[model samples]
Each structure stands twice: as structure tokens, then as C-alpha cells.
Target: MGEILLPLLILCPLAASMIVSVSAGRMGACAIGTVACTGVGISAVISIILSITLLSGPPAGVLQVTLWPWMHIAGFSADIAFMLDRVSMVMILVVTIVGLLIHVYAAGYMRDDPGIARFFGCMTLFVAAMLVLVLASDLLCLFIGWEGVGLCSYLLIGFWYNDPANTAAARKAFYMTRMGDVALLCGLLLLATATGSLRIGAVLAAVTNGQLAPSGVNLAALFILVGALAKSAQIPFQTWLPDAMAGPTPTSALIHAATMVTAGIYLIARLHDLFAMATPIMALTAILGTLTLLMGACTALVQSDLKRILAWSTISQLGYMFLALGCGVWQAALFHLMTHAFFKALLFLTAGAVIMRTGHEQDIFRLGGLRHAMPGLSAAFAVGASALAGLPLVTAGFYSKEMILSGVWHVHFGLTREWTLSGHPLWGIALLGAFLTALYIFRCVFIVFCGKKQGTSATGRTSRLMSIPLGCLCFLSLCGGVIEMPDTLPPLHLFSTLLDPKTPLSHADEPIWLVLAGALAPLAGLGVAWVLWGRATPVMHEIPGQAAIIRLARTGWGMDALYDRVFVQPFRLLTWLTHHDVLAHAITATGRLTQAVSGRIFQARTGFLDILSIWGSRGTGWMAYLLGQLDNGRVRWYAAWIAGGLCAGLAMAVLS
Candidate 1:
């Protein structure tokens, strides 16, 4: 019963996508939307039922359900299998439930568009691919879903291909993620070579028991880390995400915000053994996460475009998850991932409604006083923003974020003992980032949703489909953290024990001072926002900053420009040189000579005989051999051979 029911979590949505895709032209918009929603809805309902059953029963450390043999090549073999336990159960519930809401929301969001069927099909495919990604028990099977997600993202992001810019942005996203995929594939290959199996369990078991070489383990972990960083849109790979707003709103909510972008964090959490073996890489991950969070927060502070600001915020928030992973608090990272998904999805969808109302204007400074006109939406935004800002115990983000801050404050393992009293520099960065996160988000919230109406918006309000999901997400965002309260103030750390039982969390019972600091960070930033932008008349022009620094933050600290200078320009120059180089000139000269010879040969009458002989016989090689034999000096012999050959050829033709 479990075997049949489990893989269906992936198959059901995939089947729905195929159905809608094949019958696209014939199906009405309503039919298409129904099929898409039913596909994902069924999967979500099944997952919830399964999760409830599993939690109520005895705790199974992990359930490896093998479906069929998938790959057998050389010395490598892997099954189309799924590992079902509490850890993955958490991810599946988030993906399917939130994914379903976005699908329903998209139907109303894209109702009037003629390409509604295409949108539904692609969105359903995205959900299916994500399901496969999470449920996969082996690295090889996981990669299939990984690449599937990148493919679906490309198709959906470029759904509006009429605009060249949208297509360009889509291409950017696909290629950027692909770079990471390549690194991940290499890591998988190395793991296969080292462990002699692509099964996740075998590889992890090998790593856990010290069966694999230390050097191989380090290299494999590093390569996989590169892939995760890129997929999760951390730091350098992050530029593509902000530009990805060129897609429709639901696309943003599903692929970027709620699901695909979190794949990296999932990868790290799933393979904690491999990462634990390579402490150096995990240590570096700490630095990367700290710098990335600050980078995102600072960048988000200056952006006026609502989506771009959210995009940067996502980059920063993902940094927090990594920071927790680096601290070896796997459950904390996973907890933050779930809470972030709920609020972030709500934020993006609510922003979508606002975009729809204001004629798709995303610049927060350009719009004002939406609180009175759209009270429900304004209320939703307030909920999302408060959760995002980590407003104490009332919001899910507050609890999850405090756990991470506790991890950082203790200087867990990676930092030197000298800094134990004050904590690591990374902790300071994360703390500063926490403040900036609150400041930037609330700043935008006050500027856009408050004061007098700046410009007129469309008459239609957010639909029931959109509002219902937003309301549900708002509730989740506020209360979701109750499942994993801090050890000092919890019923029990049930979420942690089930999600990551092996490694006890060091920061579970955080110091009172640290908890107080985490509680105050958001308040401090909010106070700053309230003073700077809340009470003051909203200005469309600029906040307090010189031209240079504001421009730097707005341009993502010029990371793209720097890349263009350091990588892009040099690459283009090399391509140009190679195209017109000496080797190319020589090839061109040889091509001219061959063309001349062919022209002269075809002009002669005897050339026709040579062409016929070449065609009728084997090829140019056989014709050359025949020409070589023409030097035989007996005229009668040659004439007799030719006459007999012609007679035989004529007889063959007549028979045919």
C-alpha cells in the first residue's frame, strides 16, 4: 500500500501536467486550471495524510521505498527509490501545499490570458519536478528532477517570449543554474567513483563509516557545495534571481520563492554526513552565508522595485539557512526554510495582487496609500512583513531566526576560541543583517501601503482565489514556529528530533542575553524605519544616502558589472579572436582551393562520367582505383573490359 501510494506523490502531478499539455488546444481555461489544481491538490492531500500517519506511528528513522531498478552501467547502479521519513515529509508538505495554493492563485491571476493552458501545464510540471527532487532516495534520481526543475523554470520564465528582454532573463536564469548543475553532476560522479554506488544511502554510509578516502570526500563535498550555492542563488549566482522578475507573479512565487531556490539548503541538510566530513567546506559555508546575508540585506534596502527588493531579500534570507547549516544545526536551518517559504510565498503573491491593482507598477516609491483602498491586501502585507522582520514570538520567522542567531552567537565550531566571548565576525554580520532585513522590508511597507494615494490603480480588487491563500499563508507565517520552539521555552523540540536526530543542536538552550538580542534586532530596525519613512511624508525621489552608496546597493554592489568586466568581456574577445584567427584564415584558403577544383572538375565533359562512376559504384575511392587501372597498355583488353562492363550494367538496369 505504501509502495503504490508513495511514488504517486510524484506521478500524480506529472500525469496531470501531461494531460493538460497534450490536450492544451482543446481544453478551456477553466478545464486547464481544474486539471492543474487537481493534480497538485491530490498530491498535497496525500502528503498530509501520509505525514499524519507517520507521525502518529512509531518513529522510523528513514524509510527507503524502492520502486524499480533505474540505472545499471559499468559498476554503478541506483533504483528509482524514495526515502520517506519526517525530514523529507516536512519539505513535501511545504512544497505540495504551497504549490497548490500558487496554482489556484495563478488560475485567477492569469484567467483572461489566452495562454492560460500553457501556464497551468508548465506550473504543474514545476511542482512535479520539485516533488521528484525531494522524494528521490538516490543522487542520480535526484539529478533527473534537478535538471527537470531547471528546464521547467526556463520554459515558465520565458512564457511571455514576445518580449526579447523576458527571453534574455529566462536564458540567464537557465544558464546560471546549469553551471551549478554541472558542478553537482561532477560531484555525483566522484561520489559514485568513490563509493561505487549512486544510492544516497550507500554514499552517505560510506562517508559516515570512513570507508571512502578523506581526499575524495572533501573534493566531492566541495563540488556539491558549488552546485548548491548556485542553485540556491547565493552571492555570485544571485544576480540572475533579481532579473528573474521578468516572469509572471505566480512563476515567481512557485519556482523562485517557495521551492526551487531552496534546493541548495535541502541538498546540504540531506547530505549532512558528507558535509560533516569536510569541516573546511562547512566553515567556508559559514563565511559565505554571513557575507551573502549582509549583501542581500543591504541591496534590498535601496531598491524601490517591489519584486527586486524581495528578490534580494530572498538571497539574504537563504544566507540565514546556510548559516544554521554551517553551525551544524540542521533542524534550525530546515525550520527557517519552512517558515521562510510560507511568509515569502505570501509576500510575493500579495505583492502580485498589488502589482495587478497598480497596473503592474513594482516601484514601491511610485505608489502610496493602498491601506485604505485595499484593506485586506494591506493587512496581508502587514502580516508577511511582520513575519519577515521576525517580530518576536508572534511570527514563525521570529522563532526560527532566533534559533539561527543562537547558533551564530555561540561560535559553534568553525570560529576560533579567542572570539568565544564576543562571538565570530560572521555572527556580527548576521546580527547586522537581521537589523537591515527588518529596516528595508518595513521601509518598503510603510512607503507603499501607507500615506496618501500617489497614483490611481485598477478598479478590480484581489480575487477570492488569491485572498484565501494569502490569508492561510498569513496564519501559517505567524504561528508555524510553534512546532519547534527554542529548547528553553518549548513543549519539546519535536521538529528537531525527527528532522535531525543524530546531531544534537548546540544552540538549543540559548543564553538569555542572546535570545533578548534576537528579539530586539527586529525592533531596532523597525524603529529606524518608523523614524525614517513611517512618520515622514513618503517621498518618491530618494531616502538618506549619497549618490554613490545608493547606486552601489541598487546595482547589487555592481556584481554584474564586475562580472562583465572580469569574465564576459574577456570571453567575447577570445571568441572574436578565435573566429578570425590564423587557423581560420588557413581553413578559408583551403575551402577556396577545394571550391575551384570542384568547379573546374564539374565543367569538363569527362567529369560527368567520373561523377556517374562514383555514384553507381561504391564511392570516390572506388572510382580512383578504377582510374589507376586505366594505365594497362593493352588497348583490346581495355576495350573488351569496358564493353562487357557496359553490357552487364545495361542488363542489370533492364532487369530492374
Candidate 2:
């Protein structure tokens, strides 16, 4: 059952992609969409079934299905295999279920577009690749899927290739992610070389037994961390994501919600053991995650566009997940990953609906009082915002985020033999980030849906296909946290227990005030949001240097400008300066020399052959002339010539 279902989970969507692509010209939009939705729908069903089987049997259970030998050369080996442990089970469920809903919503979202088949084809292929990424038991096999999703993102982001900006955005995403991918590939090679195998279990066991050197472990972990950082859009590499909104909104939801960005978090969480040994790298991970979290929240706070706000929010949420991974709380990171998927997907789909209905308007400032025109959508957006803001115990994000905060609060890093770093400061920064998250997201909500109408009227009602997923996600966003509650609440370790039966996601004993503080931060943010933008004719205040601050945040702290000057400009200048370098000219000169020599050889050969042909033809012409003279005579001449030939033959024979 495991073998059959595991392969089917991936093949379903892959087959749909092939079908949609081949029959795109012949099939109608409805048929293409149905094929796409049904493929992901089946995968979702399979995930649920696998979940039930795994949960009903054992807490520490894993289901593996090896399809075939992927590679085996000398002392190295890998497999084209799938594994469904607690971690991957959660991932698959999120990918398939959320992906299926997104597909259904896209069916309506992109219905009127002419390239429906191409859209669904890429969507299904993306899902399949993500499944392979989550399910792969071999590192090398996982890299295949890693590159697969990258390719799909480029395709989907540039789906509307007629637009130059769209194509440029797609190229940006490709190039930036590829930068990280090259590092990731290098890290995997290092691990494979060290472990002599690319199997996840084998590599982890080797790390656990101290078979690999300490330096090797540190270098490998550092390399992998860089890759994850770039893929997840952490500091220095996050610029591409905000611009990635140039694609259709569904693509945004899929990429931000459950697939491409989360791959980094998943990779780190999956290999927690290897990272645990590299304490410095782990601390670096924490520091970077904290920085990225704050950066994303601040940038999101000032963004006017709806999708870009969500894009930054995703970067921030992923930062929390990475922070947890750094703190040796992999379970908490994964918990947030799951809950984040639900609400983020919901928010993007709802935003798409709003944009579609309101003449494709994305500015929050331009869209106001939508509660009157779109009550259902307004409620949907509010629910998603509350979850994104982690507005206390009512939302799933609160539980997951609380778990991460609690873990952060207890973290103690030993930077040196004489110095130790406390988690309190990191916790404070994270708390501040949490407040900003609530403020920015709720700010969008209040400005777009709560205040007086800004003359932007809803043009059409939300489609049933879109509405259904919204309702389901809304319910999940509010209730999914019940499976894993804080120590202050009822003891529910279902999520942690599923991952490891003996471990209950433990945290050191801390004061109750920490939990209270964590819960209060988001509430404070919400209150401030209401005060600023919740009323009709909201007050707009200006303070000294406020404009400068807003400008900086709005432009993502000028990271893009800095990168352009430092990286892009210099690279462009180099290319322009070396457009025709001396080396290139030298190579061209060598090629010309070879061409000249070959031409001379060819001419000489042609002349010699011509001379031989002329001599041969003249010799044949002389023989023909002699024969013509002989035949010109009468029969007496012919008989005389014959008698002369016979006498000459007899004389020659006697002489011989």
C-alpha cells in the first residue's frame, strides 16, 4: 500500500501536467482545469490516507518506498525513493491539500485567460515536483526535485511572457535561486563524499557517530545553510520574492504558501542532527533569521501593494521557522510551517479574489470599505489577517508562534569558552517582529476593508470555487492549533508526539510572564492598528523624519539599490568593458590563421587535380583520333589494318 500510494502521489500530478500540455490546443479550459484539479485532489486524498495509517499505528513510524536504484558507482550509491515519516507526512498533507485548493481556485481565477492549459500544466507540475522534494529519502534525489521546483517557478512566474516585466521578474527569481542552488549542490556533494552515500538515514547516522570530521561537519552545514537562506528568501537574497508578484496571484500563493520558500526550512529541519553538531553555524542561522524577520516585517509595514505585503510577510514567517530550527526546536519550526501554509494560502487566494473582482486593484490605499461591497471576502480577509498576525489563542499561528517564542526564550548559545549569549535579546527582537507582523497585516485589513469607502466598488461576487477554499482554510486557521497548545493551556502534544514518541517538544522552565508577554504583543499591535486606521476618515499623522523612515521601509531599506550598486552595476560595467576583450581577439586571430591555411591547402589540391584531369583527357582524345582514322577507310583499309595488326602480334610473339 505504501509503495503504490507513494508513487501515485507524485505521478498523479505529473501525468496531469503531461496531459494538459499535449491536449492544450484541443481541450477547453474546463477540461484542462478538471484534469489539473483531479490530479492534486487524488494526491490530497492519498496524503490523508497515509496520515491515518501512520498515526493509527505508531508515534515513531516511517513508511518508505524505494522505486529503483538511482545511482551506484564505486563506493557511492543513492536511490529513487520516498519516505513518509511524521515530518514528510505533514509536508505532503500541506502541499497536496493546499495545492489542490489553489488549483481549484486558479481554475476560476484564470478562467478567462487564453492560456489556461499552460497555467494548469505548470501548476500541476509544480505540485508534483514539491511532492518529490518532500518525499525523497535520498539527498541526491531531493536535489532533482529541488531543481524541478526552481524550473517550474521560472515558468509560472513568466507565464505571461508577453510582458517584459513579468519575464524579467521570472529571470530574477531563476538567477537568484540558482545562486543558492549551486551552493546547495556543492554541499550535497560534500556530504555524499563524506558519507559515501546520499541516503538521508546514512548521512545522519554518520554525523551522529562522529564518522565525519568536525571541520567537515561545520563546512557542510554552513554551505547548506547558505543555500537554505537564499531559497527561503532570507537576508541579502529576498529582493526577488517581492518582485515575483509580477506573476499571477495563484503562483504567489503556491510559491509563498507551501512550496518553494519552505524547501529551505524543511531541509534544515530534516537534517537537524547535522546542524546540532555545528554550534556556530546554528547561532549564525539564528542571527540571520532574526535579522530577516525584522527586515521583512518592517518592509511589509510600509508596502502599499497587497501581494508584496504578503510576500514580505512570508519572508518574516519563514524567519521564525528558521529561528526555531537554530534553537534546536525543529518540531516547532515545522509546526509553524504547517499553520503558516494554511493562513498564507488562504490570504493569497482571498487577495486574488479581491483583485479579480475589483478591476485588478492591488493598492490597499485605493481599496476601502470593502466590508459593505464584499462582506464574505472581507470576513475571509479578516480571518486570514488575524491568523497572520497571530491574534492570540483564536488563531493557529498563535500556537505555532508561541511555541517558537517559548523555545527562543529558553535558548542559550555559548559563543566562546568565556562568553555566553542569551536568547532574551533575540526573543525581544522576535517579539517586536511579532508586533510589526500584526500591525502591518491588520493595517492592510483596516485600510482595505474597514474604513469608509474609497470609491472602489466590487465589480463581481467571489466565485464559489474560490469561496469554498477560503471557508475551509478559515476554519483550519482558527482550529489547527488545538493539536499543539502551549504549556499554559491544556497539554496537547499531538504534533510533537507524532514526530517522536519519546520527545514532547520540551522547553526549559520559564516564568509565566514570558507566555503572557508573547500573547500580549500581537494584541497590542492590533490595538494600535485600530487606533491608526480602523475609523472612518482615518487620521494621517506626520512626525519628524517620519517621511524618511517610511521611504526607507517602503523601498525595503534600500537593499535593492545597494545590491544594484554593489553587485549589478559592477557586473554590468565589467561586461560592457570586456564586450570584446583582448583574449577574444586573440582567439579570433587564431581561428583566422587556421581558416587561411585550410583555404590554401584546398586551392592547391584543386589545381593539382585539374592538371591530372587535363592530361588524362588529352591522352584519351589521341587514342580516339587514331581509332577514327582507322575506321574512316573502306573494307580494304580495314582488312589491311587487321593483317598489319596480326603480323605485328606474330612478330612481338616471336621476339618474346
Query: Candidate 1 versus the native: TM-score?
Result: 0.86
Instruction: Give residue 466's lDDT in candidate 2 (0 to 100).
Output: 81
In model 1, the number of clashes is: 0
**Global CA lDDT computed for model 2:** 0.89
Clashing pairs in 2: none
Q: What is the C-alpha lDDT of each candidate?
A: 0.86, 0.89
Kindly list the per-residue Cα lDDT of model 1 for residues 435-490, writing each as its tens digit.
Answer: 99999999888888875568665458788977888989999999888876665675
What stretches of model 1 exceed 4 Å from their correct place?
414-423, 501-509, 536-541, 570-583, 589-656
**Ten residues in a row with the worst lDDT in model 2?**
537-546
| Candidate 1 positional error at 272, Å | 0.5
